[model samples]
Target chain A: MTGELAIKNLHVQIEGKEIIRGLDLYVKQGEIHAIMGPNGSGKSTLALTLMGHPKYQVTQGTISYKGQDLLALSPDERARAGLFLAFQYPFEVSGVPLSRFLLQAVKARAPETKAQSNGRPVRRPLGQFRKLLHEKMEILKVDKSFAGRYLNEGFSGGEKKRVEVLQMLVLQPEIAILDETDSGLDIDSVKIVAQGVNSLRGPEFGALVITHYQRILNYLKPDFVHVMVKGRLVKSGGSELAEELEERGYDWILQEVGAASTESAEEKGADPDERS
Target chain B: MSDHEEHLGERKSQGVAIAEKPQREGFERDYNKYDFRDPEQYAFKAEKGISRELVEKISAMKGEPRWMLEKRLEGLEIFLSKPTPTWGGDLSELNYDEMCYYIKPTGEESRSWDEVPDKIKETFDKLGIPEAERKFLAGAGAQYESEAVYHNLKEEWAKQGVIFMDSDSGLQQYPEVFQKYWGTVIPAADNKFAALNTAFWSGGSFVYIPEGVEVNIPLQAYFRINAENMGQFERTLIIADKGSKVHYLEGCTAPTYSSRSLHSGVIELIVNEGAQMRYTTIQNWSTNMYNLVTQRALVYQDASMEWVDANLGSHLTMKYPSVYLLGKGARGEILSVAYAGAGQHQDTGGKAIHAAPYTTSRITSKSISKDGGRASYRGLVKVVQGATGVKSNVMCDALLLDERSRSDTYPYIEVDEDSATIGHEATVGKVGEDQIFYLMSRGLSESEALSMIVLGFMEPFTRELPMEYAIEFNRLIQLEMSGSVG
Candidate 1:
């Protein structure tokens, strides 16, 4: 189907070793999709490849966003083209306060304001930006102090994950790729994060939520659930697929696909790079 | 075939070759803004070299007292005897006799901008000194080459027994005060550069605040070097008397030249009993400069002194602003920031000498090195014997932008007293690929992301500056970061 992100036969690698052998997925606006997989699977590879990460080499693939070839765009261009990624491990940027970073990011995406006279981007009025940031912080149950803190410098695991979602909320991209955003968070934080994602749900917004558990899906209620195994989507179904996988585990699906033996071998010899 | 004459020939050829080459468009634009040089207009230019005769000529020109002239001769002797420093940065390339010791840009200092010569005034106008003074400064002075061409103080501050003017005028008008405190904090014999400055010093600021008075606004002085092969030796002395407060700022810039120049300044401060003083310096010399400055402050009982220094755009710089806590319950704080781009080396830090009981001091330094540049933090903290209850902490952080850049920390701590407390911490970090990628994914260009990270790194130092200076500092950082990204 035509979608905001349409990946077809995508092959990706890192450091000369293939991680995503071949993958195909489509995420349309006005829809939410979740990809669940066991350890050693290439869930993060797909997310990073979608964002044009330099380390993730796409050997053979076609990713079209809004009918434009996404591979040709730089990472920043992809972001400016209404694409966002919530990293599983967000990097720490020391000294940059969260509010200031958000403001810069917002200005980078929005059209140049009329007040810009010197060719430098004029920031949104401080009062208006502060009001919006505080409102978003409140929605995520984040404390006010978070706005003044260095980005992810000394933040707790839950805070980092929440802040990733918070950035998505402030930036308000058309499509988001959440890479294991709920892995280390508590149940309450999981609910809050999901609620934050839900706030941006509309006909103009779509999301590809990558997670290991079906817990966040319970609150997200994605339109489709896909099972990713050995760097490819093995199956796609409704939300029940996640619940079924949660109860039965991936062993049943592995046996059904007749790749259980290879899966076990790869799992035993899992490339450490995939986990990071 | 003396070393000085040989180097002068080589420098002339190199300058011609550089002028012949095609300039990069972007760099030319940036360079022309600060590197434009007017014709070499000078009232007098000292002969290239430093000798007893030259020192006597400088003294004779200034018409100094017999004692002062004798001091200059002594400084000249000491400067000749001492060897050039070997550590910190490379100073072997410097030729003592290749530099013009002094260039008197104007015959007399002007109290009003209108009276200043049009050529010199144009330079200051381009540097925005007058505008800054009109907006926020309590007093302002502009120095060209070797002389202060313009100096003015607000009438209100002048009415409160505040003395602000160029150092030459200060010596002439307040010889008693100058004689009492001159060279006390940083004696000429302390270092080779200090001795050189003492021997041939020209334009700098001299400020004094009376007891129980406060100058809430900053007094600023801007120094500009106009001619190639010029050496600027500015001597500044500030006295904040008992129960007084004052803040003074100095900024320096020089036109870009293919041949190297020298800037050796000596700044001495006296924070008297129960007084407070802050001295801020933002030195952005051209990349062809060797900036060696000695700055020190003496803190009396219950007094406070602070040094906020930022160094940028020099081929090599060695400066360590020091504080001597000389009385009980005195405090000293130093905040230093350095940025080293391509072909630059910023060897800068702070020194704290706790000599009295209950004295406390803190030094925080942040440096950024990029594009094959080197930044070194060389610091010293010494607490003498019997200085009980003395406390000091030194924290240094360095950020290297690429693999080619380098950072080093050399912290020397000497505590003779067992009762003193001291702590030193240093961290060196590179701009991580993950950090850059994360910022880039948020729609910032690579350079923009890098500059943002650097600006954030320098926040502690910038936040302490006045609002306008903070803005200007950020803009300078952004300009330095542009074209740095590969």
Candidate 2:
């Protein structure tokens, strides 16, 4: 696939329990792709597996980002390669200031700031970095005073999601994967967070947003929405599928797929009898 | 042995009161006399060494006030009575008296930098003490051996009723206040090493911040041990009065020697109501040194105390900076970074006692060990029965560079009240191969990648340090990484 993110036949497992089975996905540049599913449907599983999270064992699949094998890279390497994952449950890294953490993340992506420790590099002083971080934070509705706080520590649920969005905007990752960004946000908070995500859409950046509800989809309006059930994407459609799923619910699709499987099984049994 | 005991008295107590007392006698005495005429000779050293009589003589020679003397005597008794602790790093190789107890420089104290002896001044110059003071520090004091020889303060600070001087000089000048508050936070009997320090306290800084005054710039003390077998005991005491604020920075270095030098000192801080105090230390003791120091502070209502410690050197070091939340709304924090290389063991941590309601504390400790070095974090977070609504968080991270290195954490949490919130997290691991490969693929050498990973591991602590110290600390990490990767 000629796109920012392309995963073909992606099969992933944890402790031999296959969580994402033959998952195929592609997100083009400047497009917002949403993966909607119920709990235990491997939505988060696929998100983590795509980002090179160590626990997810990827098998029989090729995850390519802009024609490079993304599966072969470490999490940080993938992050450096412009693949960012806003974890549904962000890891609390104490003693690391959010500003400093973002600075390192930015410097990792930008080559000019990387200097040997022994050499004196005349880089931007901390004040400028602080100001830039504050500007980004203000854009994301984050308090400026949070620059000094430990990353994700003592953050309210909405605050945590906002911090994730703030990092996504500041780091400017090309393929940002947000897993359940609207899980804990209030209605207004969800809208604000969606607005922040919406602001990052561009030809240079593509996003894969994972959600379990259609409420956020109303605000985001992903160009393509895929339905995932039982570790695989059962159907693919446009943004209308999200509205359809919200209206018809997951049971209708599950029944249709389940009945089709039973009918195929009965036909196969009858063919065997006629052959005998 | 009897004759040796008799000869100990003739030694004049080495006048320095080294780390270990009686058994470290003649070796310390001869070394303190500037015996290295060639300036290029080296001496043999030991790893673990301390003793009791060394404590007694250290107390006796200082001519300490009667109460302090008695406290030291009590400390000596405790040192003899208590068993060596077994919970932290291994202490089996330590030999009491094998270490020089007292090894002060042989010279008269000089108030002016120009008046300091040429040799000592050269050492200080090499360490960049004078230049650092001139460039950034508001005040500077240089201590060699067991006493501060040259001290200076900005005229503005002096005029603002601030007092900064050597601890001994402070006692002599302000005897009443000194006596009233000395050992109030950390009594001699608090620990064996503290007792040892109390017995032979020497060249530490004494700072008094007047009420409602705030010192804009940081005052610094640079301690350098230029002599072989020298024992430097510097005592420091800081008092921040009501609504006052102060920042004190201290750094230490010792010349490369084969024989071991011992450093034991005490630091006591008193933060009055609404006051804030920050103490920062960056120590680079050579591998032939044993550094054991004690530091504690009492935080009054709405006061705060901070300890920013970086331990980059020393063969074996045991130091824990602690804070006591003695008043409501008081706060305390400790940010420490330690690096232990081959033949070094860094056992350092912090303690926080929430004795008042609504008090808070936080401790962030980071350590890295390489090539047979051992780094350990041992800490305590305690909340008394009446200290309701207290909160504390402690995070310890130790990075082992190779298979030969070791890291351990022993944290004690005691919450005597139901309303307290406490959290602790620790991690011990080696540098992941993938992290190294990723950095190497980006064109960094293996050593560079390793250094970057190590720096990243210590980023939590370094990011909190001041700019100059952060730069210096990164350089020290690079130096420690030398010969580590290749």
Candidate 3:
């Protein structure tokens, strides 16, 4: 398997407050990687920083996508570069319809063709694209009337999350990062949204599913699970580590890391040559 | 000491670039000292203030009907008793007695442009009035002072039961219908300026479209104030009968005068059921003039009313065109753009009152200010108690070109019904220097980039104008930005 998304020594901050300190992670193609952490453990910060959000300041880091630097691009450029972030809260741009926005986004991502029809240049028509979109919406069980309405204006919580999944399915990016797509969904909606995400799993795509509970992990089985604590990753393991954390919680990991640091400090005085 | 009174042609003949010409310090008097010399010209015009005597005299001079004179007298009393409005733009400097209420060129109305006097024709030629009318307009009414001397419309439009003529001629020809709907949509006492217009209004457009007729071409009226200290009050009335449509455009300009002149006009539109009416104006009055106008419309069932207004010049302006939705399924739209420069204050917006069910309205306003000027948006959206299922949206965006400029949004939204939905959005920001620098880096001059950006900001408004008016609007904005640089 090859690495679809990679981050090395990622250091992120928000207004001089360091959030993600010296973090490294990777997810391969056709695999799901779940990151679990406590409340202030930089889970959402990492997700947004990877998507190139303007508010997240990356003080020191290098994010590479297929052997190319990802930090040197705008948000829209990043999205066009096959990176998608299912925002925990999507922005509502009133008066701009969803269908119109998608059309513009599709055109922005396509290269200009040199062929002309009659005296005008011809591209893929929007009508055909809309038909394909309607089929995707049917699979996701979304209301057909939402196409004409403003994007994210007056949408319910569950409906907004479903729309995010639908956007991921339509854009079909190389990498998808879900901040918290299941935070506000009901039992049935959780299943339907999970099905929508699983439909996008293939050899051409990879997904980073950020979650806080093992309930969603019952549906999405990640190949690797990483534990993040206090802005740094302390442990990495296979699928069993998720079950251990779910059963015993993070108390043991915190106690073990604290004792290890104190023991190393005392041993430094006894063996100065070994420390140097 | 503004130079709004400088004649570009005169300065150009003297081998001077008018944009870079120097001005005398502390100049306070009007530069036009030469009075009318024609032997047939009157020594003095009518009185400066409003009176029944002055109204009656104007009607008699036009050979108007008895009913028309009676309406003028009624409007005269309304003008006399009404007080100046204390709202909107500044009005502390307007003096009624200091203005010359009327001025007529020393000739009868001429149908041919070549027959007009050279001095009067020179001004029209400099303004490019005749060429634009001949090439692009369906009809053109060129008013030199207080009276229109040339009025003509295409024969094809006249054959389709579309009547386009001066208001004075409309009164003589269609007396019964003209008297019925005149001042009905917007009454004489609607505002002080409207009352003043009714009392002393001289030259304006009067258009009537018969049922099932649609004139695709736009009719235009060009008003030029040549005389010094003259007040030009033009009254316009448009009535679109069932299933008819028309687009009317009007433009104005004046030479710079030291002493301020006054412009008060009234516009009343009656859009019948299943009809559409569009009214556009690009008023570039000299910076020494005060432009105060009252315009309104009454839209019937399934009818539509659109007002595209652009005010680029004037020291002080207080004008808000309104629409009253009187029947179900009626629609109203207003796209207005205003620019205020030094010593200018533009207080302009729109009002939409929904009185019937299923009514809809949209208002988009864009304003730009620079050189310590102020631009204010004062709008209103009112939905009555029984007007259910009404939808309204208002967006106002103002751009300040410098730190000294100011922009304000004072919107009044009153919804008495539960089923009505309304949304209002406003944004105020200064020009980003990075945007200017980026455009300048591409080999374009700074002024050209600024002009292009300003035009793009007003694209939503200018795209609604007719071809000729849109071209003229671009030219006017280019002229206004000649030397406006930081």
Candidate 4:
């Protein structure tokens, strides 16, 4: 209940259809949690809802970040409050250079760069900011030409995923939810992106990574691995739980839960609505 | 439930913050601080409404020759005979009787900056015309209300035999050269607005680049309308002779007013054989102004013409710049951008005509509409018979910022030659919530995110502008986008 990112009994609906049902989660300070699920299992849904995407409607329950009611803030306010979400399929925003976008974003997120007297917003010294940007980009191995090209306007899938991680390293949010950040990346790119995210790990940072494949877990070390199925978390344990699912698949857990429900129903000898 | 509605105030403040002119990168200055006002005084003024007597009086005031006087009367007859255009934005709100035909702020154009009127000089100074002209322009003219208040040309260009002056003086000093190509590209009877401009034209730039002499630096002009219910009908004529090249930039801005103003002008460009000319216009009229302008170019053999136009402010604007490729191997291109904010309508486009063999043309238009605004692109591409090997392509892209806005594209193509290749592409899209969320996740407020997206959408046109004009363009757009998202 007092974690960096905590969600309790959350229900989400998109365009009148429920996508996430009774989902509860907790990510503590400096802890990395991985949510692994099959396709359409609402892993991406949970991340988007946390980021306050207007299309994903939160129907019930609560999401609190660092003991604050996160839903009360707009998406930008949430960002300024130190929360970030790396999109699964990044949107291409043409005409905006990556360098300019990053500069403005850094200014907006940092407290010192807020609007000052006479309503004029202040910015950091250009030379200092540019030097820092070049250094971070070099760490991510992004080409200098990428600075001038429109943000993800014509990026390949692997390039898009890497750029998302680069943004995380630049913004350095307190709680980062990376939705399939390693989805389409090649082996080398996957290692590079994971390294960028790994460098940000500290007492000031917490992250919830959502993915369908366990291959990324080899590079990104998760303290806890959770299995999500049909909009609910079916199981949770240490890192070995991911190895079990990767080998045996999800049918064993579904079988156990299905049989358990049927046996309990027979013993009760009552209507289904009352059995709960 | 979340306190969803309680954040409107925050959104509004955030929107307003984006509008406050940010210091340009490394410039450490804001131009919005320089906006000032002056009393609407005049040395001479023409009466309201268009009449034959008023046209004759205007010609007499300038001491025009008999042929020019006769031409003015003929233009008056055409304007009286034609009716107001019924299509393309609302024109019923324009009142001819309530409009003042002309208001001359100064008696004569100042040869030196100090000789200019104090009030008029301050206005242009605030607009940053003098500073920008000093750095890069070959010549510059500033028009206030109805007259050219100040004009100056660099001595180098004067020595190179380039004629840069107000249209009135171009008529008086170089009568033969001015009278030959004037109105030939945009004839008086071409359209109602053209006829109206010819009838009551007053102050605009006239440039004559001699044969084989290229004017490397840009020749620029600035136009401002200061009074309410006033009319500005300026006529611009540019002639680039054989093997000569020139680029002319014109910028317009006006103060906000309670009532409506009308701006109807005619621009004629004659590109002689082997010559090239580009005309760039940045029109930031106040929201109360109704702008209807006719601009056209005639290109001779192996000549080329380009129009780079940006229309960012107006209540209702109807303008479509056109080029006529009259000679073989002539080329034409038009890149236009329009932004329509609250209570504004921008109806603009480009037209290309292939009248000779082996002619090629291209038209690219980008438009954005927000806060109940409407932006439309209406274009035409025609290849006349026997004009073989003609190639034309038209691309139009529109972005609507919010649900209240609207955008549309209407393109007409006529190909008479069998060998011609013509293609057209248009897209109309609203700002996707996904894109907005992406930028917002980066900590940009909703309005700032939207404005950045809009600027990115207009990068093609803005990149073509010079540094000073581009900065001014971005500043105007930021102001227009303020408080637009709530």
DockQ of each: 0.77, 0.06, 0.02, 0.66
**Candidate 3 docking class:** incorrect
Query: Residue-wise lDDT of candidate 4 within A150-198, one digit each (tens)?
Result: 9998999888888888888888888899998888778887788888888
Note the residue pairs that clash in candidate 1: none
Off by over 4 Å in 2: A1-3, A115-118, A122-139, A259-276, B1-92, B95-154, B157-202, B206-218, B223-231, B235-248, B252-259, B266-288, B294-313, B320-486
In the range A247-268, model 2's lDDT, one tens digit per residue, is 9878787786672332234333
Displacement of the residue A136 alpha carbon in candidate 1, Å: 1.9
Ranking by lDDT: 1, 4, 2, 3
Model 1 residue A79 CA deviation (Å) reads 0.5
Candidates arranged by TM-score, highest first: 1, 4, 2, 3
Residue A12 local lDDT, model 1: 86
Q: Write model 2 residue lDDT over B202-276, tens digit each, in one string.
A: 667878999999997787664322221123666788999999999998873322222346677788999999999
Show the colliding residue pairs in model 4. none
Name the 10 consecutive residues with the lowest summed lDDT in model 2 chain B.
Answer: B1-10
- Candidate 3: list runs displaced more than 4 Å: A1-4, A28-30, A111-124, A259-276, B1-87, B90-172, B179-205, B209-235, B240-265, B270-292, B298-317, B323-346, B350-375, B379-486
**Which scores greater on lDDT, model 2 or model 3?**
2
Worst window of 10 by summed lDDT in candidate 1 chain A: A267-276
- In terms of lDDT, which candidate is stronger, 1 or 4? 1
Specify the highest-DockQ model's number: 1
**CA deviation > 4 Å runs, candidate 4:** A1-3, A115-120, A256-276, B1-40, B107-153, B223-231, B252-260, B484-486
Tens-digit per-residue lDDT, B1-486, candidate 3: 001111212333354211211111201111222112223244337766656677788888889888778777877787778666545565666787777676554433213444333443443343455554421111112343323332334567667888877787788899898888988877776666776777777777788999989987676564322221123777788999999988887764322222336888888899999999999987766566688888888999999999999887666777777889999999999888888777667878888989999999999999998766678787888899999999999999998988876777667788999999999999986656544432332222456546655765676777787665665666556545655211
Candidate 4 residues B1-486, lDDT tens each? 001111322333343322211112211111122222323445777777777888888899889998888878888888778777655566776788888786765633213443333443443433444444421111112333323332334567778888877788789998998778888877778877787788888778788999998987777664222221123887888899998999998864322221227888888899999999999988866566788888889999999999999887667778888989999999999999998766677889988989999999999999998766778787889899999999999999998888877787767687888999999999988788789998998899887898788888889998998887776676556555665211
Better of 1 and 2 by lDDT: 1
